[model samples]
Target: MLVAAAVCPCPPLLVPDVAAGAAPELDTARAACTDALGVLAASLPDRLLVVGPAGQSGRGPHPEGTRGSFRGFGVDLDVRLGTGNAGPAATERELPPSLAVASWLLERTGWCQAPVEGLGVGEPLAAERCIAVGREIGGRPERVALLVMGDAGACRTLKAPGYLDERAAGFDADIARALGSADVAALKALDAELAYELKVSGRAPWQVLAGAAENADLAGTLLYEDAPYGVGYVVAAWS
Candidate 1:
């Protein structure tokens, strides 16, 4: 597939981490994530990749809730960094465009992020510098830009309904493919009022949900409800 940008959904990419729910900034970040997910879902690509800054919660260096890899987003992927082998949870840091591409700065900067060694979020890079770094990384296919500037330390709790809704958007097509349905009714089978099965029996990964996702059988099974957000995003595609 060709590289593309869904357009910038949020501005001032780098923001301080604040408390969740009550923190306005974090809320905005969630909203941005939600918006981005919507567009990506609407596009209905065969594969989806989500890259974000993981937090190391003193459990060996990777984020607690994130999976190092997953098969659901369509194919193979390894886009996680944090505690518990996920990498260290570092503070947010902003640097100038000039410093982001500097090997010296990247080596010296305190912006610690997984995928990158010895960098912390506290040390941010200039936009131009970051772009340069991206350039240095070398281009390939599908450059989906998703800023990991959200509540640095704030906790995000997704309600059952919200999670189901997100799953519908993120995996709607996948659901359709699995069910062999031509309509969007498969994902609509999820019910907000049902109990959440955050875990599946005999699963190695604790966070992996087994039966949580609703069945894709489109035979008049429509337990899921439309999102309360009621907001549709622009599905602009670019090369």
Candidate 2:
């Protein structure tokens, strides 16, 4: 059953090398992520699962020790999901970009509290399916913890990735409130089509989290929320 969870934004920019000189821009977010991880560590779960958004080619399960690279982001850096002998499947399938960012955060924190694994949720995955997958995970007998990664609306400003949209701020605001309070119903009720239109990458994965915590009765804390480079990034912890 779910024991704890940490939610964070999954931008490659979270990596100092990837962000270069602008790394300082995200120092607060990074610190918040670190604190969120601390909560998971405190839970002493038997298993840790990292969940993130992915494209068609990146969807599905990634085992512990699975490899991920930031080379695609031009950093030439690599990371592993966690410490362990990677199985044949792990060796063959590389982690998606969001998962790679999670891997980077795990490495930064030196996580060793539990066996780790990853699941890449398709950005366009239906909320029902996402919730179902999460239900299965929460139903597992082992004490489980999750590190969920994805970004909110990308259109907060005129220079944002999706450009300024009048609706972006409201969407992100609702998301922040839901994550901050661990309001599973609100997360599960998120409008998928609206999220797609807003280019919100966190929608599907957040729904998965909502599903997982359905029976966990976790309490949440919002650690950070901001729109740097016009991308909505939020950090939260549930215990």
Candidate 3:
């Protein structure tokens, strides 16, 4: 069952090399992510599962040694899911961008408490399916810890990626509350249609988290919340 969880945004800019000089802008978010991961380590889970949005439906079982790269984002940097073997032949598939960001975070924090793996939830997946996947994850006999990575709406401001949607703020606010309070029902109830319109990519993975924590009695803390580039980025922890 899930013993702990950390919620983070999956922007490639989180990587200093990808962001270049703009890296300092996300320093606080980076720190919060590190702290959240530390909480997961404290939980001493039997394993860690990094969940994130993917281009396709249910795209992973990304093994501990799976590889990811940021070359497409203008950097040649590469990351592995855990301290497993490193090389081109380590795994058959490359992680989706969101999972790549997750891998980067784990590498940045030097995670060592448990072996790491990954699962990619499709952006448009139904809430019911997302929850079901989460339940299956929690059903594993050993204790599991999760690192959920995905961004909230991208239409918060005129300069946002989705370009100024009046409803963006409210949507992000609700998500922030649900995450901050560990409100499972709220997460599971998030409207997928509306989320798609708002450009929020975290709904499926967040619902998955809710399913895993259903009866886990986790206490949540909102570590960070912001629309730095008009995209809602949040960092939260539950333990």
Candidate 4:
């Protein structure tokens, strides 16, 4: 069992730009998550890039310089998941794992857009967060499959899990629901997040995961839940 990781950092699912007139509910994002997982079911990846966030700078430069950032865990998923081969872009229907996070993102709102690039970050949680993930995996010498997607700041500073269980106490419920659901569905369906991790036989601890759960909370924003992986207990703290 080799411990490997991948992340996919994404901007707010429903951007003010992408969903101007359309009024999508968390359920809509849920619908999108459902469709996205279906796509992932057919096509799995080698590694998982987990992205993070960096919050917003409000409107400044450009037409709308409302630069939101992330320092969570998923950004690493975006870059690592498809690092080996960037052969071609995924089709609207194809839904690559990185962009697949959009499925979960869609569950939240219809008022934001996916990030265009990775830049300008805030406090990142990748190093400390992933360590818990990695340790739970126990540095297995096998292909560790993960689904990472958060903001860019956290994405940029991809690090191992350190002593970073500082914010697990004040998490809300929405974050919990998202991670819990994602983790559960991934495992049960053996098709989505849990589904794929099972393919690689990866596992992490609940307490370990809880340490970095805030990465999801701080950065998850509108994530529905953590899809299941293998041998891993879902640990989430949220409002």
Candidate No. with top lDDT: 2
Once superposed on the true structure, which residue ranges of model 2 sit more than 4 Å away at CA?
Answer: none
Cand. 1 TM to true fold: 0.25
List CA RMSD, all candidates.
18.7, 0.6, 1.5, 18.2
- Candidate 2: Cα lDDT at 50: 95
Tell me how many clashing residue pairs each candidate has. Answer: 39, 0, 0, 81
Residue 133's lDDT within candidate 2 is 94
- Give the TM-score of each candidate: 0.25, 0.99, 0.97, 0.23
Candidate number with greatest TM-score:
2
Cα lDDT tens digits for candidate 4, 97-194: 22333333432323122212112112222334434543444344433233334321111112311112222212213224444443322222221232
Runs off by more than 4 Å, candidate 4? 1-6, 13-18, 21-129, 138-144, 153-239
Q: Please give, for residues 1-239, the per-residue lDDT of candidate 2 as tens digits.
A: 99999999999999999999999999999999999999999999999999999988789999998999999988889999999888888998889999999999999999999999999999999999999999999999999999999899999999999999999999999999999999999999999999999999999999999989999999999999999899899999999
Please rank every candidate by TM-score, starting with the best: 2, 3, 1, 4
lDDT tens digits by residue: candidate 1, 1-239: 21221221111211122122434633443344345334434444433222122223212222222332222223242332222243233222222111121111112232133222221221222223333333432232432222222111011124422333333343323322322222223323322122123211111100111111112111211112222232111111112
Task: State residue 176's C-alpha deviation in candidate 2, in Å.
Answer: 0.5
lDDT leaderboard ranking: 2, 3, 4, 1
Model 2, residue 150: displacement in angstroms?
Answer: 0.7
Provide the overall lDDT of each model, using Cα atoms, as 2-decimal numbers.
Answer: 0.24, 0.95, 0.91, 0.28
Worst 10 residues of 1 by lDDT: 200-209
- Cα miss at 152, model 4 (Å)? 2.6
For candidate 3, the TM-score is 0.97
lDDT of 2: 0.95
